[model samples]
Target: MKITSTKLIAATVLAMFFVNNSAKAQSLPESKLKFGIGLDGILPVGNLTNTANFGLGLTPRLQYGVSENVAVTFTTGIYHFFTKEIRIPSGLPGQYNTMENKLDLIPVKAGVKSFVSSNVYFSGEIGVALQVDNGGGGSQFIASPGVGYAGDKWDLGVRYENLSKTGSNSAGFIGLRLAYGFGL
Candidate 1:
């Protein structure tokens, strides 16, 4: 019989790799279908000045499992913001009316969620947003990053989103969400 140091080292590394992977596999959730809805409250920043101040919105999501701990998500949401109001001449003489400032955003995105632990996860999304207001409407690119705790039937998370407009400026906000889902 013979024993070598290099062989022993290689064997140890291989064993450790398998043990780590098995532990991760054990913590992964089973694949299934899930649906959830959430709400977001945001404060505008950067290029969104004058056009947006504060916002509140709703998000509805559908997720389909691809692996034990991985899922593909389809999401859409809308946010409303009150910006700056301007005074305009009313139809009657010597009368001025204040125009209300409101901006609405609708985003549709496809994303992937990966569970890193039994109850912890991270996700990223890229999509397009339809921006509408009293003046005119346009579309822009949107990106989002999120992290949260997920359970068997519910989850809570926080996300930061960036909406890039055609011009030089961009709009962004941070939001919190609580969602519930069921397996099928």
Candidate 2:
């Protein structure tokens, strides 16, 4: 009898926890989807050993609530990276006025969102980052993550992107995103 009572109590607690989690799953302040535009700073890390130069980019995003705390977002944008220094195996640095690796990326992602309070929410997206160009170039695969806040008229975001798909293909891409959203 004691064992059964303990199991019942545990089940009740677990059910309550799931109910609470299901309620706190979104960041939007209203009932509609949001459309946003923001600035981006995409930079490569540890590439030019002694180089402090970084890349600049821009992003436009669409966010919809699959649930209160889970959102599906699709982002498409351009990334420009300038390299004043790049470390070589020769133990020296090379300079490039413009790196041809700059690209246009369309990231299709689904993110889990948790509303910290009323107006602010933390979110993360893990999805396919597809690369394409206007010059009839090729495409590659990337992984992306983002965190943002919802405002009265807009949403602000910071994102990390990974595109260097070599070996295990684990490279890190970090950037900032600022956007404004409207309902559908």
Candidate 3:
């Protein structure tokens, strides 16, 4: 059976909601602020895999608890995608030359995190990603959904991030983030 993207996303959200409802309730600090820095490893997917081999990112985030199990967040980050070498035809039959390409992006986002358990949470974010290149690149809209484990001082999460631009194909990646966090 073929599963569409919309269906998959809906299923994931539904599953997370069920998990949250079934898990034993835990208390979270209210009206408290926390800061975190995360290092990410990304694997290109969809059309992005055609050009990029892998990616790395650094992100800093701030979270403010609004309720016992919910928090609002702001995140900004830099991501660099390493591109594969491509061969270009050299104006002659059976002759070619290779060139390398790369991409850098900076993202600004706002999101919400809802705890499912004492250490598990589900998060969703939406924002814009600005491209950085010699050609003066443009920006794309970004949306990401993730699930994570947050401990006293360490957090780990996995997310699927999608970026869309006008007049171009959308790109995506699966990312894993390891973070260190503290109260502020």
Candidate 4:
């Protein structure tokens, strides 16, 4: 039931992302590379045991535009965090600990985006991610549909990503990237 709801929400967001196309095309500079950073806060929606300590996170990414509608990205950093209050039943005094509880994943995704109208786009990408904790193995498939405006020097976007992956449970990290893309 949760999976079904998640899929439905993803589909609706994608539909909104593709709803218009008549805006002007903002030209990019000679360089195709763009850089961006974002703040992300998420609760474990489909897989998890706790939502009590799912703190906010951040992801920074860089992308190179292949054309107006296609791009590839490399993200060198991501963080998962938590804060837990521990109580000792026997020995140690009770304490509150804020554990950023970080495990970083560096991912490179080669993907494409298509503008449904001038300001809305749909994107899909697949890539390998190296789990920075325990040397475990994992990979990801992220498909996002977004709406954005290309400012004179940057692109501002809001997107919903259906991020599927392996090993997040053991890795002590969240399973996805919900982000904003900036054209560098």
Best by lDDT: 3
- Write one digit per residue (lDDT tens) for candidate 4, span 1-184: 2344346446654654454544334333334777766565544433432433564546576766655544555554554545344433554477444443334445555554545544455544445555465465655544444445544344455544445565553212233335555554
Q: Could you give me the TM-score of model 3 versus the true structure?
A: 0.89
Give the 10-residue window scoring lowest on summed lDDT in candidate 1. 19-28
lDDT of 2 by residue, 1-184 (tens): 2233234334433443353463443445335677777677666654321333576666677776665554666666666556453333544466434333434555555555545444455555555656555462444454444456776566666655545444543444567666666666
Write candidate 1's Cα lDDT for 1-184 as tens digits. Answer: 5433234334433443342232243122456677888777777766676666778888888888777666788899888876777678998999999977678878899987766666666667779988766655788887777777777767788877778777667667776778777655
Q: Count the backbone clashes (under 3 Å) in each candidate.
A: 0, 13, 0, 4
- TM-score-superior candidate, 1 or 3: 3
Candidate achieving higher lDDT, 2 or 4: 2
Ranking by lDDT: 3, 1, 2, 4
For model 4 the local lDDT of residue 81 reads 43
Q: List the lowest-lDDT window of 10 residues for candidate 2.
A: 1-10
* Candidate number with greatest TM-score: 3
Clashing pairs in 3: none
TM-scores, each model vs. reference: 0.73, 0.61, 0.89, 0.52
